[model samples]
Target: MRRFVFGALAWPPLLERVLGRAADLRPARLPGYAVYGTGGGALDPGTLCAVPDGGAEGLLILDPDPEDGARMAYFNGTDADGMVTEVRCGGDLVSARVALHDDAPGDGALPWDQARWLEEWGPLALDTARNIMAQYGQTEPARMAGLRPYLAARAWARQLARTPAPAEVRMATTAEEGVEILRDRPGHEGFFRLRAFDMRHRRFDGAQSPEIGREGFVAYDAALVLPYDPATDHVLLIEQLRYGPILRGDPRPWVLEPVAGLVDGGEDPETCVLREAVEEAGLTLREVQPMVRVYASPGYSSEFFHCYLGLADLSSYEAGVGGLDAEHEDIRSHLLSFDRAMALVDSGEINAGPLAMMLLWLARARAGLRAGA
Candidate 1:
């Protein structure tokens, strides 16, 4: 049987990755259907929905292997339904399968803009597709849906890793110049991922080190903000039960920390911090100050932090419980004087590293901020 598939939002590179070969594509148009954008959030790409009447233009794949068709279905995710339809290809109407979604747009929904999507989301989508397709026959669609966010975070990490930091005082060598990766494989995948690598790197003495095996936790870029009221000289901190300490067998797992969240793929750190502030503490920030960007632990993890100081009015807001119910977050916000926050740091009460660092940072800038306010 000859198989054909129509792609409206699928980029050529993604199709190539999924098919494991160059795709045989032709320009085609679905005469009685329109493509609309649906279901993307800060962390994921919006997908396409084909609905009756208005028409859409896309590429048609000719004679895709049955296995390739299955792979494409997985890529489309659980929300998509494939239907055999006729599309105009050149001068003739040809039979092809198109993916449609149940949540079709109603009146006045804008048509899907392929150009804008390519510019803003192409890289992340491609990187995410690579990770998704790597699981090919191994992962189920329902399981893959749950894994998408983590995979997107990993892809975003890879994107951020491309920009080099200042290296004047350091080795001044890029990863390309310093490290030679031999084999990289997945150790585990869930809410987090563990990756094992066999690699070699240049030593300080100008010699290539022997190949060695190592493993690292794949994590996300996080935005951390210490909300401060310059007029009141107080700061807001949230207390939450942390899983890391629990895993480490700590008696006290509920720790006080800055309002923080994982930066969604393609989301700006400042924007993420601002959004997290409202979600975690119910306070809208008046201004935000960039504190520092650093690796949480460079030794064996990919976790990084973009820290900030958020200026807000603390006098009107009281300490209370706040957090998104969807995430099952039981967060308690605490409003305290600057001195009291520092006292917590001094008394070992504020054990979270990022929060403590941000507090100390706030101490140095407190005088100027108050004067300016």
Candidate 2:
């Protein structure tokens, strides 16, 4: 039994929850303990005068004035030197203070009878008690003491405001492909990949492809970008050689595409779009506006595309040679009016999906942009 000096404070519900959780993890898993109060003179009789080495102690304090409803509660912790620990419960963070005193025979503060404080308010105190117990002497206690209620309220608000979207699917396409290709395929060590491709209606399952074995193709997130000029109404498109075109047996191997690049690990979408804008087109954008976020081929591939319409001064920075030397990216840019670009899309010269989408969107917004209306 432990001594608790409850001063004009009624027990709250938080204490019960904390003690219930702590009871499961009590020191050495001992028998159930008891909690009472100081009685007779100014305290209740159930208070314990001496707390055992592995027992628990708690205190409840209330303002003496009737109009004052503010209260403070504390848990007497025995972890280190019988220290006083603080915890947050019922919008208040209470700190427990501990002290040792002699049991004088006729002291007015000593209790005459043992009444059950636990039975009346035990369950109510569980949450607060467990919180304080877990945070004994930890930094969390001090932090909770300052703005416990505000944090609770904020958490509630966040819960209410949160709208979770569908989770991105992650499938392993080629962890071992990199190693296998390094040993067997020897030529393209610089670009070893396990790519996921859509096959919604196509008969090409990755299992059937000779390119993959037991280590099947893993799904990947797609990266996309778009370049636009609200001022000149001119957009720059890049023509480049792609491995996919060669694999597909296209007579014209080079394909038309938007100024885009594959997103690398640890890179944000915004950063990637701007970097790709410069690398593929030699154009530095003032501001990039996000237009749409879509999956390139959602039914069969895990590649999601992030499209952006970059606002830039395209008058002077056009028809420039740009590409990373290491990547062997011999990219050429064609700067033309939005109408002409769409005309190319209408003529099948522009075959890339992202480039076509951006051109159509630009067509819808072109009249307003030209009239400045």
Candidate 3:
């Protein structure tokens, strides 16, 4: 059994999730050390450091579950930096251990604000802890720290999926009526993840289906843009090597698609498209028209995309190579006449779904879009 003095950053619910049990946090105070935000941002978690006469107000957790000690290590991190020390709580000095991280804000960087953190970063941190703790023995602290933002984004996406559309389908698309998730478990972890499910759901015609097991490829929601120029009557397409086609044994794996990228956590779909435009094709977006927001594939993946029709001047645009090297993206852009692009779609040459959908949607809305509306 061991006891620790948590600082202002100590999140009780978060720590409980990390330890996989119910933990009671008693109000406490610690002296001789301080906690501050790591450089990662106000939301990146905290960095603890030793200081003279400085004190931290937090909670106390004693005798944590032993089964999750290794898992807790990733959160508490190695005690290599901080040491066993004495702190005062309610006028009583007690002995406890403290752990600190080297990188990020340490002492004197930013004053610890528990109330503000709970208001602004609390939910994000708690959601991120769900995935971070699930990795447990499978990953290291540094890697987890780097993945914090994306993990939080992924958690946000997962929450969005859980929100049922209000009364959309009377028979019950909402879990309260027809669906129930019995067990949900994480399968793999990394830049992308796979989640497994075992559950039962309602079938059409008022019958319940037997329990069925399933899994889904968890991917961040994305934003896709099909740049179009009415004055020039041209549309831009980006071609790149896609692993899905090659893996599926398609003879031609170089798939042509729009300027698209995954949406970062807390970013707007419109902003994401504009950012992707510059990164994928070096195009400056003047105006953008939202086409539709949809799932990439409902059967096997949770990937959603916000499609857009970006209005831009393409008269002087030239076909060339562009893409961010950090992501290993080697892309080539092609400007095709509206007629020629549709011809390719008809001939089955343009098979990428987002591009195809945007082309058709543009065909329907072209007249209004061209009229400067």
Ranking by TM-score: 1, 3, 2
- Backbone clashes (count) for model 3: 3
**Could you give candidate 1's per-residue lDDT for residues 206-316 as a string of tens digits?**
999999999998888898999999999999999999999999999999999999998877778899999999999899999998999999999999999989999998888
Q: In candidate 2, what are the lDDT values of residues 299-368, reduced to their tens digit?
A: 4443556678777887786496789996788998888888788889999988888889877877777677
**How good is model 2 by TM-score?**
0.44
lDDT of each prediction vs. the true structure?
Answer: 0.79, 0.49, 0.75
Tens digits of per-residue lDDT, candidate 3, 1-373, equal 3346453236777778777887755666667566775434324445566667767666666665565445555654442434566656567777766554543444457766677777766666677677777777787777876676677677767655664445555554566778888998768887678889998888887788898999988888888999999987899999999999989999999998999987766567799899999999999988898898788898988788889999999999888998988889999999999999999999999999889999999999888777863
Q: How does model 2 fare in lDDT?
A: 0.49
**Maximum-TM-score candidate:** 1
Q: Which regions of candidate 2 deviate over 4 angstroms? A: 1-219, 371-373
* Candidates in order: C-alpha RMSD to true structure: 2.3, 20.6, 3.5
Count backbone clashes in candidate 1: 0
Candidate 1 has which clashing residue pairs, if any?
none
Better of 2 and 3 by lDDT: 3
Model 1 stretches with alpha carbons more than 4 Å out: 1-9, 39-53, 79-81, 102-104
- Cα error of candidate 3 at position 267, Å: 2.4
